[model samples]
Every structure is written in C-alpha cells, then in structure tokens.
Target chain A: MRFQKLKRFSCFVFYSIFKTKMVKKLASKNNKIELGLLENSSFKALLNSKYQFSKKIVIVDENTQELCWPFLLTTFEELKEAEVIVLPTGEENKVMEVCFQVWGAFTNYQVQRNDLIINLGGGVVTDMGGFIASVFKRGVDFINIPTTLLAMVDASVGGKTGINLDVHKNQLGVFSNPELTICDASFLATLPEKEMISGKAEIIKHALINSRSFFDELTQYLEGVPNDEILAKAIQIKADIVDQDFREQGERKKLNFGHTIGHSIEGLLLHNKIEVTHGECVAWGMLVEAYISHEVATLPKNELQEIEQLIRGQYETLAINDTIFDSLIQLMKHDKKNNSDKINFTLLQKIGLAKINYQLEEDVILRALNHVFGQ
Target chain B: MRFQKLKRFSCFVFYSIFKTKMVKKLASKNNKIELGLLENSSFKALLNSKYQFSKKIVIVDENTQELCWPFLLTTFEELKEAEVIVLPTGEENKVMEVCFQVWGAFTNYQVQRNDLIINLGGGVVTDMGGFIASVFKRGVDFINIPTTLLAMVDASVGGKTGINLDVHKNQLGVFSNPELTICDASFLATLPEKEMISGKAEIIKHALINSRSFFDELTQYLEGVPNDEILAKAIQIKADIVDQDFREQGERKKLNFGHTIGHSIEGLLLHNKIEVTHGECVAWGMLVEAYISHEVATLPKNELQEIEQLIRGQYETLAINDTIFDSLIQLMKHDKKNNSDKINFTLLQKIGLAKINYQLEEDVILRALNHVFGQ
Candidate 1:
C-alpha cells in the first residue's frame, strides 16, 4: 500500500516538473492516465501549448450539460469552441446504437484523429465515450472528466472502456486508456445521496480485497462522504492491481471481488427496466459473496461479520424473489469473465486478500443467493 | 526489404520446428500472420496441442459459404464442431447493424474468452469479423482465412480490422491482428475476373510506393492472377513499411496513396446505390493520384506516363459526372487522414518512392478529379 502511494506520488512529481501544471496526478501504469483535480489541471496550458487539437468535443448527458458543463466552459477559455454532444442520461442509453449516433455526429463535425473528446458525465458517459473515441478511425485520444464519485475512483483505475449489449454487462468494449482524467470532488456536490452510497460501496470493496488499514480508516466515513485522501487511496488500491494486469489475465481478477455477481445482478435488473444503481447491486453482491467466501474459501467468520455489519448499516437489503435465482445463475454463466459453462468468481481468502478462478457450482451459488435474500 | 522475407523465413522455420505441421508461412512482423497454402496448414495439430479453446466459431459470408466452406470443412476435422455464422454479401452489408446481429449470435452461442473465431471469407468477412471479435467482451483471439486476393495481400499486411459506417468507407474500426492469418490461393479459383483485377490494383500500388524492382516484376503478370511469389512480395513491401510504422504517423501513409481518393469515390458511389469494387476504385484512384504526383510532387514524368498506361490497360475507366467532381472533393474533406481544412495526401516522389503530409487544396483536388474523369 505504501509502495502504491509512493509510485503515484513519483508520477505527480514527474508531471509537475515537465508539464508546469501542478495537480495531484497519478500515471496509472501503462494507461498513461494523468488524473488530478479539475481546478488544478490547466486545460488552457495543454491546448495552447505544443498540443494542438483540430477539434475539441465534450460528451455530456442531459444532466452533466446542465449541472457541470457551464462550470467547465467558463473555467477553461480554450474549451469555449469545443462542440457539445449531449447524450440521453442513464445506463439504459449506454448501447451501440447510442455510440452509432455519436459517431454519426462526429462524422457531421468532421472529427479527425487530431481532435480530443472530453467525457463529462458519470460511468456511462465515460465508458460509452471511451468506446466511441477508441473505435473512431482506429482511435482518437480523450480526456475523461468523471462527474460522479463512482467514475472518479472506478473509471480512473482499470482503463476499461465499454458499453453494454442486451442483458450482458460490458459485452462490447476494448481496453483503452484516456490521455488524461480530471477528477475534482466539487462535482460530487451534485451527485445524489444514493450515488454517493453506491460509490462508497466500491471503496469498501476495495478495502476488503486490498488493505486492512484502508478498511480500518473507512469506519469513520460509514455515513459521511470520504475526503480526497480516502478517494485517492481507493483509486490507488485498484490501480496497483490493474497496473500489474491490464488485460485481466491473472492478478487483475482480484479487483473483481464483488463485480462477478454485481454485473450479473446489475444486468438482470437493467434488462427488466428495474431502477437499480450499479453500486447498489455491487453492495448487495459483496454481501452475498462474503457469505460464500466464509463458507467455501478461508474468510474468517468474525471478519465476515464485520463486513456484513458495515454493508447492512450503509445499504438497504434487496428483496430478490426466489424464482429469479435461476435467472441470476443464467446471467452469471454469460458473464464476460467466464470462459466456459461454469461461473467464474473472485472471493475473499481473507480480508485484504482475494483468490481468483473460483468455479463455484450452481447449488452453492443458489444457496448463497438464498442466504443473502432470506428466501 | 530482403530482411523482411528472411525474417518471415526464420519465423516459418520456428513454427515448423515447434509444431508438427509445415505451412509456407510468413510472419507479417508483429501481426503473426501464418500465411500459406490451405492444404499445408494443420488445424488439427494446433487444436489438439497446447492450445485449448473452449469453443470455435467460423464467420463466413454467403459467397464464401457456397464456394469455400466445403473445402475448409473437409480439410480440417478439428473444425467439425465449430459453429458457422453466415453474413450477407458485399460492402453494403458491412455495417454495425450486421455486427449487432453477429454479436447477438455470439451471446446465444455463449462465445467466451477462450473461444476461437476463424474468419473464412473475403475482405468484408475478414474485416467485419475481426472487428466483431475485437470488441466482443473486450476481445477474443481470432484466426483469419482470407478467401479473396485483396484481403490476402492488404488485410494480411496491416493489422486494421473495420466495418463501414453509413456511406463512409471503414469509418468505424480498430487496428488489431489475428492470432494467425492463412492466405490460400485456392480461394482465388472461385473469384470473378473483376475481383482478380481489383486485387491486382493493390499489388500495383504496393510496388509503386515501395520497390522499382517489384514494379518491373509485376508488368509480367499484366493479364494474369499474381503467383504466390508475387502475392508474398506485395505483402512483404507493405509489411516492411508497416513494421517501421504501424500507426500510420509517417511512412505507413504511403499505403494510402490510392486509398485517399479511392475511399471518397467508393463512399460516394455506395451512397448513390452504385456498385463498384474496392479494387476498381483504387485502380482509378491511383491514376488520379499519379496525376497529382506529377503536378505537385517531384515524381518523374515518365513514371506517371507508365502508371497511366498500365492503369488504362487494366481497369475499365469510370465515367464520373463533371458535377460529381465537387461531391468527390466534399467526400475527400471527410477522410479520416485529414487533420485540418486542407486534405492530407501521400503522393509519389518517383516510381517506388512516396512523400507524406502534402496538404492539397480543394481546387487542386477538383482539377485532378476532372483530369482523371476526362470532364
């Protein structure tokens, strides 16, 4: 954990001395992610200096255009001419058809390889925008300005850019990095309470699988918004894992501790037109998986109790129907991580450690689901 | 250029020594193209060995399914269980809608990370299939079995995988290489005379941009299909240039000599419901670009004259309306290569030499368009 902070700090010093824009930044391994506070990151310095983009595009949803775009446009004078493409808000709109429309708009604008795309929304905007830019004439570099807490910590880490296909989560995507990511906590002021809770779920999951010290510190923020230090620490824990395995061939799966069930549940809810935030699904998923981990893997009973108490206090329990357990199993089988008919999972060996490639049987998964839902 | 063949030869030896099967393979630099005669390749050897794919998928178009699939099926017993997905024929079908359908099929088939996709068709199949596999669940490794000469030389050279967007040619795409690319000349037996001429256009462009000696050798195959040696040489020239610069920041643009105008003309025609082969467009485009090279670049007058005569002798001249010259110019403005208002071009300095980054104006492009169309 110290080494992770040390690496990010070294990257900050390197960007400061060379670029002349002093921001708390980290080079997320090979992704070349230059992330910092938006106020500190000088867009004017970047645009006016040696970097000359032919066109600048800001991809925002209806929400971000209204809530965040004005602040961004007035703060950076160089971005006044940047074209704005307002996407329809929410996870349902994150699809290839939407990407196709944005690409059509790009064609209408004659967006070239020299242009830059600034994604100014939550995870959907960043993910869909990243995919659009990555596949447009091979690729065009982009800057991600995540307006949500989930995006700042989660999107800032793995460098995974994607859009969903039907009932499958992130079924179509590529491993592409943004040229830079600007994360200013000021935007979190506009985020809903549920979103804030949704985001904190990830931070809790990060601590559970990465560091005991991180989990211990998170107790104070049980009902409060985390400060900049806590946010940076959560990002670093994920970055440290992703830095080793960008392709998710091995150690990277450790970061998928809760995401295996989270994605399946999230996708099932999304397809059914149910209004469930991704973080809410992930939170419930972690609780269910934590139970399985204690029973199957070597996660201690007392450690599991601590996790259960923390999650129960912060999140509402999901009232999943017993009939839907089979559907959940079906979605898990279709998860992108699985290479065969069996479901693949990453469960806690203990707090601060996770084990990958756990091909848990159907009955075990069903029993775990029942235990969590009290069905 | 000689080092390229030597490098490929060494790679062939490497594959031969390591594996039981011996194919006349040429490793197209980092693309790992295992190109050779179809009969010589052993799918069974590779399948049963260290490689363990969970599923096998073969993507073919209507044309390849009828004329080529039987040959492939009878030869490789290992592919018996492999599911076949047939796509609609032609450049018009090469769109995101078709890809969406194929992805839906992939979902139904439970295509996973360890699955293998064998693209067994012409340029449309290879290109679109490559794109589909590249984006599905982030990416899945694929093998390319090119059934057309255009794909054998061009697609095998540069690792670009793409699909057309609306009337725009290859507007949505990515640069990704297959795990293996097998180019069998036997597929050419089913190819139409028009298609053969189209393939020759690229081979001619390769020589014009790379080697005078290669150009001299090509004059012998004026009215005939190029031998394996000629195909290998054309692939080598492009591969040699691409090995130097894969991203097309510099030298790789030389390959776009014919493509700049070729794409514009191809797109314009396709939009107007006119059918024109990709190679026919390229051949006509080379004549116009050669005209530009003579006027703007320091290309020898004799070299331009030779190119004109050879092009006139092979390709049926296109009757582009005088009014369409403005339309062609408009389409050229939207070309992905252009970074500014001025159109970017790669013109010949001489036979076997190309100069990149020539920002040609609209008026100059119109003049060349008129000259080539005889308006």
Candidate 2:
C-alpha cells in the first residue's frame, strides 16, 4: 500500500507538471481517490482490462481545454486518437442547453458509441458531461475526473449526473455507473477553501454512518491535517458501502444521513443566495436530524450531542425562522425518499451505524431543529 | 388482447369533440400499436413487488390538463386519489428546464420520493417526465402513458427518457426502466397528422426489421386504418424485442436499423428548421443505408430494391445536396455509435437481420444517397 502511494505520488507529479486542469483533474483526483491504495490498483487494472479499454478515451470539459486535450493526447497516444470537448462551466450552464453543446461536440468530434467520456471538473462539469455521455446516442462510456473534494467523495462515485431545470438543483438527472474514476487528493489544493468544506459534508456523512474511528480522525483534522491518509480512509468507507449497494436501495440510503434536510437547506440557501456552504448546511442538518433521531428514532443521545458539538465546532449555526421552516418542509416533501406526507430521514441508530426513513412527526422535527438553531 | 381492446375502447373516448392535431392523426393514421393490452406485465409486477406503493398510479404530461385529466378522473375513478402533474408540452420543453418544473411541482404538490410519476404524452413528455422521476431525490418510480405513436411504439418501452440540449436531441437523459407503461391506442385518435406520421416511421421500421407479414398488413392501410388488432400486433413486436433485450446491448440495437443516419438527419433537420418528420428522416436513412449495404456489404440485391421501393412509395423523395450530405455526415460522427472516424450503420445483413457498424466508406454512402435522390 505504501509502495502504491509512492507510485501514485509519482504519477501525480508526472500528471501535474504539464497536464491542463482537465487532465490534471483526471489524473490528480483519480489518484487521490482514497479507495485503499491496493483497491485503486485494481481499478487501474480494470481500466486496462479488455472490456474497459476497447473504446477511445474522451475527456469532456471546457475549462480544462488546454489541460485535458494535450494530456489525453499523450496518455492514450497508442489508442489511435482521443477527444476532449470543452463545455461552458457553472451550475446555471448545466442544462440541456449545455447537453446540446456537448452533443454537438460529440458529433463534431465523432465520439463513438463505445468510446469513454472522461468528465473532468467539479460536480457541474461531471454532472452535465456525464449526462451528455449517458444519453448521447443512448449512452456511451464515461469516466469522472472530479476536480473538487465534494466531487471526489460524493459526485465521483454515485454515477448520478444531471443539469438543473429552472432553479431547483439536480432536478433532471440519471443514476448510471461510470466505467472508471481517478480522484487525486492533489487537486484539493487547487480548490477554494469553501469547496473543500463542501466536499467535507459527504466525508462527514461517511464518518457519521459507518466508522467511529474515521469520525475521530475526521474531527481531529476538521480544520486541516494529513490530507492523504484521511482522504484514503473516507474513500474506503464510501466505496465499501457503494460496493455493497450500488443503487442506494438499502445501506446506500444510509449515506443520506444529513442529506434529507441538508438538501432542502442547500436548495433554500441557494435559492435565496444565502452564501452558505453545502458542508455547513449538511452539518446543521446532521445536528438537528441527529437530535430527532435520539428522541424519537432510537439514536443514542450522546452520539447526537457529539454530532451537534462537532458541527458547531466547524460551522456557524443559523437560525431557522418559520418561513424557512415552512419552505424546508415543503422542499423535504420533494425528496425522493419520502413516503406520502412522511418525510423520511436517515438516522444514526448508534455512533457508527445508521437507519433510514425514521419518520418523526412535524412538531418533533421542529423541536429538534429549534434545539440546533439555539432558539 | 381482443377483449382487452374492447374493454379499453369503452374508456378510450376522444376527450374533445373538437379533434386536436394529435387526435385527428390517431383517428386516421395506420400506426399499428397495441395500446390497451400491457405485454410487459411481469416487469411491472416485479417493480410493484419491490416497492410498496402509497400512490397506486401517477399521470405525467403537459396536455393532461386538457385531455388526460378529465378522462382519467372519470374513467379510473379508483385513481381519484392518484396524483397528476401537468408539465409544459413540446420538444423544446423536453429539457432540464422542464425537469426543474417537474421537481418544483413535486415539491409544491408534496410528491414523495417513493411516489410514482406516470408520464402521459408524446415522446417529449414521456422522455422528460421519466427523466424527472428517475432522478427525483435520487430516484422514485415512473410509469408511461404514451399518447403519440412515436412514444407508444418506441419511447414507451425503451426506458430512454431525456430532453434536448441545444441542437442535440435526447442528449441529456437516462435509461431507467419505468415500473409500468400504459400505451392506450385511444390516445392516438387525438394526435395530429404530422405527429402520427412522425411515429409511423418507427412502426414501419419495426415491420421492416422484424415481421414481413406485419409489413404487408401495414402497407394495406398506411394512410388510414384505426383497427386496434393490427396496432396491437405492431406494439407486441416492439414489446417482444424490448423484453428480450431491455438494456439494448444486443437485439435492441436492431431497433436502431435506420436511427444512425436517421438521428443525424433529424438533428440536421431540427437544427436547420427543415420540414422533416423524425420517422420520415429515418425512412430515408433506411433507404440510403440499405443501398450502401447492398453495394458494399453484399446484401441480396432483391432485399435492397424492396427497401427502396417501400420507402419511395411512402415518402416524396428528396435530394441531398453536397452541403446537406456533409452536415449529415458531421452529425453522424457524433452518432454515439462511432469508433474513430468510422461511421456505424445498422444495415440489414438480410431482410430480417440488421448488423451494426458495417463500416461503409464515405463515397459508398454518397453513392447510395445519389440512388435515393436519383442523382
């Protein structure tokens, strides 16, 4: 494993010097994916396997124009030719309109049916690019080169790709798996601090649901420390769950611990231009939902308190007003996990275990939320 | 099946005495799709068993406000509690933008993650609505109520739902199968002539590829035939193939016999705002590609001539100029089926069997184009 890290470290240095953002993200992010150094070697072998490497590798992104194109050209030099499509970046740009742009690129570039599309960027780039690859001619192959940590631990794995329709986030998408992904921790150094924290939400969720030791490690390094080791641990935790339940039908649902209310808060905050980070909002969601879990859903109170304390330690807590509460509830109803009027939350049954759809009453939820808001 | 059609007929009353374009086409056109009888009953049953249904049914569409809403309310009174979402209609509206509209509706209406979304429209509505349902929260459930022949015979079964991104059609989408699909032929009586013809092309393709007897039956009443038995036969053929190869890895690609070139033509026509139907373009593609197959790939000359004759009888032959040819080729490059510069054509190795990527050179394809254009 240590030798594997050394090899990846060398690969990272080689990938970084001349590779543009697109290829850099691909080589960098993928290199950093903490799915155990040994596991990553297996994934690398899979990429080289006859089944996977039969198609041309095409990296799709706009910002990484200079970055990805030249790098892919050199990397897959023996594969006849490779393609790099540039799409406009940003969430607002992540729509079918962008998909059309990508399709045009596909057509213009002559992307084949079996060719793999390597999406290189943050979530927006990967989401829309993956989407374009997914449906272009009824889906071609795709890989994710998620540049941000949020993407590394979250978007990079799940294979959920989509662009927004109207103001709602990820409103139009698909749940398709990728052929390969390369998440390099080195790319995290390039991201804005806020985006780093945004990625932390998913990391926190992973720690909260599966591994108490991981949680302890994460808490100690909440601000900053030992990026490589922590990243590897986080990646291992997520990969294990994903491997167990790919479709998120059971154990995978537990990954949504903070996401139920977190998504609603993020939706509201994004809609209001409230400038709150995704990780921060999810932290708050974990706090409140954990409290609810303790009271009505059999989650341990100590764990709930610890979760809240940890969240408070990392993020500035916000007050949830009546209007916000109403909207949050309204948004929660749209969550794909809800059954009828019952808004389902993934609760911690213990510090290192989770359960889904812990249906607490509206009043009980409000009380738990109030406690978190310090109201 | 006959009894099923009879039972559905009682409830299939055309909503408006004033026939819209869609209704008029359904009443007049000879698109043989078995609307009332569900063939993939087992698939639906399997899905239902997997998830506990709070809402037994869902109706998703744009024109539902005018057509399906009143009809469903009166007919399936048992579904009075069933939720209905009215989306914006049309190809332009089949986008991530509309998906957001759906998510907003789901949110506003308190649609849960576990609830089902029943798509009730043509290709645009089914594709977009299905895409929304597939990604709502993470994924919920979806059903298809294809009103147009294009959707009923093809889009309804394939689990290929997506919206246009820019010039690319169905570029942003997913391949999540619906729990159920209700392809009521009664909905066709309300479709317009143009829309009916658009769907007819696919019906013709199915007949050409799978069942010659069905083809013989179709030619007898191409212009005007409202017989439910014949329509059901056509739909059954599609359902049979769909059931055999749901993921489109093998036998399902046969369905794209004309689509490689056909889709490029549609993209070019749609982009240039040319007056060409999707089916019509595919019909032309079938003719040209068949010629290429005969000349380059050693197909029986008689089969080639039969294809040409069948297409010529239905469509007013159109000539392709150098510019159009180049543009079409350009679009074909991005057909999501290419490998390198080689364009893949799903051509008939025989009348009943189609081969994919039978690498036809540019000159050979052009010569075939000349034959179709009589150049």
| Best-matching candidate per DockQ | 1
lDDT of 2 by residue, A1-375 (tens): 343345445546644453422422122221233232222333345456643545554554554554334443434443344455566755556766667656766666555566667677887777877777777766787767677777778777766777765545676666666766776555454456777777887788888899888988888888842365566567667777777776667887888888878878877877775666667778788888888788877777777778877778777766456557878877776666666677788888887888876775688877876776644
10 residues in a row with least lDDT, candidate 1 chain B? B1-10
Instruction: Give residue A266's error in model 2 in angstroms.
Output: 2.8
Two-chain DockQ for model 1: 0.71
Error of 2 at B268 (Å): 4.0
Candidate 1 regions with alpha-carbon error over 4 angstroms = A1-22, A33-36, B1-22
Off by over 4 Å in 2: A1-108, A121-129, A162-168, A189-201, A216-223, A227-230, A318-326, B1-70, B81-103, B186-200, B211-233, B243-247, B269-276, B318-323
Tens digit of lDDT per residue, candidate 1, span B1-375? Answer: 343334334534543543424456664576665555566775556666634655889999998887778766766777788899999999999999999999999999999877888899889999999999999999988888887889988975577889998778888988887877777675676678888889899999999998898999899876755666787788778788888898878889999998889999999898888889999999989999999999999888899899989999988887587878888888888898998989999999999998899999987777787788864
> Model 2, chain B: what is the TM-score?
0.81
Candidate whose lDDT is highest: 1
Taking the tens digit of each residue's C-alpha lDDT, what string does model 1 give over A340-372? 778898999898888999988898888888888
For candidate 1, the share of real interface contacts preserved is 0.82
Chain A only TM-scores, each candidate in turn: 0.92, 0.80
Give every collision pair in model 1.
none
